[model samples]
Target: MTTDSGTRTPIRWGVLATGRIAESFASDLALVDGNELAAVGSRSPEAARTFAERFGGSRAHGSYEELAADPDVDVIYVATPHSRHLEDVMMCFEAGKAVLCEKALTMNLADAEKLVAEARSRGLFFAEAMWMRANPNIRRIAELSADGTLGTIGQVRAQLGFVGPAATARLWDPMLGASGLLDVGIYPLTFAHLILGEPVSITAGGTLSDQGIDVNGGATMTYASGAVASIAWTQVAHSDNRASVAGDVGLIEVPARFHHPTMFTHWHDDQLDTISEPVTGRGYAHEIEEVAACLRAGKTESALLPLDDTVAIMGQIETILDQLGVAAR
Candidate 1:
């Protein structure tokens, strides 16, 4: 950011967790030229110290409280688990720091709304770190979609799946809001929402573990525009992780790992057009840039990832979980 006197300043960032995702985010934070990782916090001081030393945070706080209270930190990235997102977001708000929280923003729709409302009430900047929304290729696709590139998209399909270690507490433990639903299913849900808007009707089917966590699921969302988005996610199998949007006149296909694509293709009348926009540094830098841009412009919420949209996506997930009987523990 450029000050009135022509001095450039980097957004000073603080990270609220030292988990694997936290590390990836921090590593990418360094790639954005106008951002700086100045602080890190973890429940364990040793963990904080280790992450900060490795990730370029100048300060290491033994607790989230200390990190939140740090005056030098202009923004905080809450990379905690889905269950902890609301709490961590509020903590940063209470400390007067701008926040970029991980998604799905909270465990439920009501909680997601509560976080946004409180952040709004305090006149603080808040946004969910849905990185794909800020991806250049996705933004271009959205622009083209709105401009009738894929005229009247009647169908959309998206899927994300992986077979991580089965026993990971966050993946199966209901107490930690464990369900493949929130953990990875959110990608498909939010992707659908971005392309098709909120669903007028959501039909869901899934395989649920005896312990009450949904291991995998498929959802069909119908929009008032006569569009239907078919979404699939799983933790027990490896899926193609691709997405496609189709309409009467043409088709737009995002290749494997669509949510994190380097480019996308458009097909029409035997003609194909490809847009290539490679990702930078794990692709988290774009999201960090959004936070910085919003904060520098003094905006309370991001236009790309609106507060209402976050809650709406949460509501859709809530509905899916209800249908699958995958309530949290």
Candidate 2:
């Protein structure tokens, strides 16, 4: 972000996949001022070229490795599936590239830890792409909760669900590390974590598919502060995607699709206040901006989306799946 002549330099970004998430991130990347989608990479050459053409990338690589190795790309966004995150991100690190990888960090907690260790050992910039944490509204909620504005938080409730296509391999396939919990549940879980740290105990139950992936599930966690969190996620039906945090003095509610909320309401002292935060395109831009800021500051990790919390959440996901009897692959 510094300049010899006093003009800010754009951070050049490379996207490592051509999936829907990649396109969304690219769209938001364009919305930011000092960032550009410099390159795109996909296993299929045509896919890479087509994505670059649509997203305004100047270069397209036929493989993820090639993209990681591209000298012009300052940071690479690993947008591959959850199962491929560890491998893909490690490749980028080996190529001496900073990385912002899509969430679920990896298939399990161990792999997530491996990534953290590798990134730390190499002193490279790395972070999980948990866009929700970077949302202005979500960050505001966390601030209120942390600063005692919510007043002795005692409970948090959240749920996310949709009747997704049963035939969609990404939703039903175990090989792809697909599950309602990993795909959507992590949001509610993380919301709770941001308010109440790690839980002392977690009790969970849910339905599992014939393919051994979770179709629907919920958990109730008890924190050391005596706060309790209840969270649920499902791909089996359309459930209210809302979230609420309750404390002794007040309550805050995030409307449907809380993960990318633009506004939320708080109630206390017989007063209801609505707060609105301007979200950059689709809300992915905040995380992108966070990554760029971290790189410019020479920080290896994002404070908003820390690697330790990511690993802990992955552990929570693994424990929840085990309780649901989803039989890990």
Candidate 3:
């Protein structure tokens, strides 16, 4: 077991993409005390150089291999599209470097399992950057639910959706592994998983594009405890993005973006109560700190976003896709 050391030594990071998500992660890492943006790699040297200059990092390389081979980098952040996560993370793993991969861990369950197995076999840190799982608000929800504040948790309903224009955009692009389900559905699925655990029975239906990705979908999950959750996600319509948990005695409703909600409401037998909290920096810093903490302690995975849970969530997504007749290639 790895223990937290009082002496804080910065964990050097090698950024593996120059996309918006990568930039967001870099900005968030700046707010963490014990993380260093050691290097950056991009398909284009000019892009990598420009990103490095803007982010205040010295080593910018043109190829992923160069960045992965850098001995000074303690970990690599795989910020590429969902389809590339397997290749990017596997490269880093083969190079003997730890990885902090972006969410939707891979295109599918098989690749995700391979990455997890490799990390476990090598005793290196690996985590899906499901930042919401590390948020204070979500943590509080978990604590309250576990403590029985919701009273036997009978049902959960969550939706995350946004309107997108066409197949040209990343959200609609099949080559990029972009779709409503994988891009935004993970939020609701993860939220349900947090409160209800893995579902015993999963049923889903959706509309898929000619390109073969889910454009809009809804999943119904029934847990062994008789708790049921309904989750919906879409790129063609805008949704409330709210989540609710109803129990025998009371209910709780989370505000928009429930996964990273700004406030939540609790109703116990007609008395209504609302709890609000502020979060720091785009809210990605918390997960960055978590990865750093886990890596520094020599841990192979995060307690908040365990590998098994990630795999299970991906499997659920796979089932949903199977039911929808959409393949995530």
Candidate 4:
């Protein structure tokens, strides 16, 4: 079930970084048929070798350059940090490889726009790896919301927070584009946007760290139709991590850990209906499928996880952080 050019053939995935997220992606990719882990590249030779051995990659390259130029690799998964995404993705695209970069696709909107434009000009398939967007339950919920299952959508609320180790590099480092707003808060923001579309007006305010990183923050977005969304996120303390969509007729409640929730409740007046959905293979496979499907079909972007949506999401993050007086570096 492969083609001559190889890019349209069964996917041979190359990972650009040997990080925790990269390892998770490779683990889930194994569940996908018609796909193979071709290679892994890392700045550290040992890290690349170790990742390939564990993740079933056939070859390990000590440098990213080698992986990018690999003819055997049809696509490269850029699993670097928020700050490094643009640089890493560009490397793959310059080498003519399709890319699936992780969420918070870039540090700011400017970089996101550049990446999108580059992908288009190069005629390469590109997608932001926002796995939640690919979830079946989330998709169903989006459909219901659009079809008026919840009536006139008035207000949506979502929050995600957890305790993190103080010494973790990503959490404490400003250069890594560290922000509670970008890292975890983007989930609440995107969840609202997916259901409600872009907001007409955005007003946000929150506290930032002494080092100028957003540790805890909140945002309020209003649509032209009078609907509103309230979002919250923090790494300083533990919260319920809940979400709800309220409308004139009813509301849908996504319980704890709403971003990756498995169950949700539909409330219509006195009636409460609980719906549960099963997930497949750590929830990463769905996003992978979207990428693989696009590449196979000669598509340059995914309808489910479009680059425009990714860029818009980052723009929203910039607006919120700016109003909150937090410098999004």
Candidate 5:
């Protein structure tokens, strides 16, 4: 059911890319009841037209500038590569449009700070599309931890990795802000931050490509709470992509894609309890709904994925990058 405002209208959305991730998000947006695809934009006019036609958008623009300028677009989803997020988001901000940009928010903390400051000064809605934070299961995990069901989380272990076919693809290109740490490693790092808070000490070891990007990296985060998190990310190997949160009482294991898993299990003593919640589409609808809900309530940030948390996460990323001797372009 669609949550109704006084006017009972769906939030209008403009998609700002034609990549695979963009298409996945657009397909999920269709499943959301209170959101409408108003437009799509791409560097290639034909790609934009095709995407708009398939997604039922009212217009397709050959350039992001036009899409951002379209008055009918209530919010813009910047789905471009991390290297281009700053440029794309600034253009939308210039047009007085709200934005939900893909994660890792930007190539580095400086850009993230700039974007957040601009959004604050302009009083415009802006969010890093960390879809996992907006997920129901992750929220449940947070709640369980808060309620002491986890009995004080002692450690968090998470890993995300995939074998990339293109050594020169965006995932492997440093010039394009392609690295396992930012692209995939952030998942485990963010998950650790979410559960264990900021760590006091960080150590990272990784194999760097000729382009100076991390192909595989592992980090150990030691928090002030005495809790430890071992997180790893890679583009050269296939991992289970699972996560485990260990506490005094027991542990919670997320099967796969721990970031967006359908179900998780809690092992307490001799009992193994499972919680399952199926999501529709690709699970992107959850975040889309969150953005619409915030906009309708006239909030500049999401309660779930707050701006402060985003900044803190970016800071953690910076620390990790510095340790790895890698710099974002």
Candidate 6:
């Protein structure tokens, strides 16, 4: 099922939505080698046509089902909202297509697990589009932490937030499974987990919108290593969007918008070291490249963005939501 080393066929990609994120992904897709934007899908034929035309896509489908069934496409990127992820992804699985789904994976942990089960059973390649894990600098940070450069990490702090756009129903509508934690908090939570393992307990507090969705929140997670992480997310205000990991030996600081950082600083022995790495097209290209490589290698999952970690993050999000009394639909 794997391609020979000498084979160099480009991986054909179909996008399953025409929203803003899909546009960004399409734009980034061009920056990576060995991939093509082969097709696009939208509920409206006109919308699909517009996207395909703009992105140089060969085909435009009026519905997701058509895109899923496109024989030319080797993989489909599911860019739909959190609520539609399970349904949209399952459609791709049935059509025997590899999938790279947008993160949070789904609205809840149960749905995330179901997606994992389906993909594993079908022997299809799948990964959460947790682009941060694919980021070169973030990967380096993990390596430095693991290699004893930052020994015995004892704390991590990360936060991401922006004033939610009032006009966008996707961010304010509870029916869309809109919550700041799902939208912004997942980054900080994942960053914490990247440096430290899963936490033993989580204590959280937040504010809910009139529509009964979380608007702002913060959580403190305590791990078995006696390490603690403080993470925050919000849709009501602008946060610094910074992150850091502290250890007994040193500290590493990722600048604002740390989730997809291209550079960070390492502090040790009364000196500071700045680390920088190349990032392709807003950092999304790395994840795209990862999927293409997995398919070519005949792998069903990516070690960088493992499904178990994705599910665990979803569980953490669910617990935070529950404690904040944000009813799950």
Alpha-carbon local distance difference test for all models: 0.88, 0.93, 0.88, 0.88, 0.90, 0.93
List where candidate 6 sits over 4 angstroms from the true fold.
1-7
Model 2: per-residue Cα lDDT at residue 193: 89
RMSD of each: 1.3, 0.9, 2.3, 2.0, 2.0, 1.4
lDDT of 4 by residue, 1-329 (tens): 36676543568899999888898899999998778899999999999999999999999999998999999998889888888988889989999998988888998889999999999999999998899899877887788789988899999999999876887879868988788987899999999999888999998878888898888888889999899999999989897899888888988989888887687889887899988787778888888888888887889999999788888899999899889887646
TM-score of each predicted structure versus truth: 0.97, 0.98, 0.95, 0.96, 0.96, 0.98
Q: Give residue 282's lDDT in candidate 6 (0 to 100).
A: 85
- Local lDDT at 86 for model 3: 90
Expressed as tens digits, the lDDT of each residue in 134-214 for candidate 2 is 999999999988898889999999999999986777888888889899898999999998889899999999998887889
Model 5 C-alpha lDDT versus the unseen true structure: 0.90
Relative to the unseen true structure, what is the C-alpha lDDT of residue 27 in candidate 1, on a scale of 0 to 100? 90
Residue lDDT tens for model 6, 146-197: 8988888899999999998899998999878798999889999999988887
Worst 10 residues of 1 by lDDT: 320-329
Using TM-score as the measure, name the better of candidate 5 and candidate 6. Answer: 6
Residue 160, candidate 4: C-alpha displacement in angstroms: 0.7
| Candidates sorted by TM-score, best first | 2, 6, 1, 5, 4, 3
Off by over 4 Å in 1: 1-4
- lDDT by residue (tens digit), candidate 1, 115-189: 989999999998888998988888877787778877789999999999969668888777787888788889878
Looking at candidate 3, what is the lDDT of residue 42? 93
